[model samples]
Target: MTVDYSLPKPELGAPVRVSPFIRFCRWGLLFAGIAYGMKRQRTLEQRETAHRANLRAQKVIWDEEQKKIATQRTREQLLQLAKDVNVPIPADFDTQYPPA
Candidate 1:
């Protein structure tokens, strides 16, 4: 039996070359994805900032409301004290006097 030691020759044809247009399209798609990601990040940051501002505004409003409530309570107590001392109840005092 004769042993074959010769290697098979490779087939020759036009070299496999990537088209420039295809390369351009790939690069364009990559850049478009980066731009989209950057835009999305900016939008999210803006939304977060706006949300924080809204929360701060709400806190300020709540603090003001608390102050107003405290002031009303103090006024009511003063009016009650005046009544207890036999002082004349002013007609303009609109708060309902508590039962003794």
Candidate 2:
């Protein structure tokens, strides 16, 4: 017998039907996921900006402290040198000689 290729084959199972409500729910879920991802990204960027600002402030404070310490040490060294050489320390010593 010759096989006929013109007729449409019968479906093995029931045709799948997607309801309107299910389609709407799927779209809603997709939108919600996109919104949540955008919000999360913005939050992370804000946190990074705040962290950088805090680091810069800390660095400024540290630099000021270092300068103060260096100046105090220089003053102490100058006093010791003057005492060793038997020379009187000048009244405007800090202005007369700056730290190297």
Give me the candidate number with maximum lDDT.
2
Question: Cα lDDT of all candidates, in order?
Answer: 0.86, 0.90
Superposed Cα deviation of residue 22, candidate 2 (Å): 1.1
lDDT of 2 by residue, 1-100 (tens): 9987898887688778999999999999999999999999999999999999999999999999998888888888888999999999887886866654
**Candidate 2, position 5, lDDT:** 81
Clashing pairs in 1: none
Give the per-residue lDDT of model 1 (tens digit) for 2-98: 9999999988998888999999999999999999999999999999999999999999999998977877887778777998997887776655433
After superposition, candidate 1 runs with Cα above 4 Å error: 1-15, 63-100
For model 1, what is the alpha-carbon lDDT of residue 85? 93
lDDT of 1: 0.86
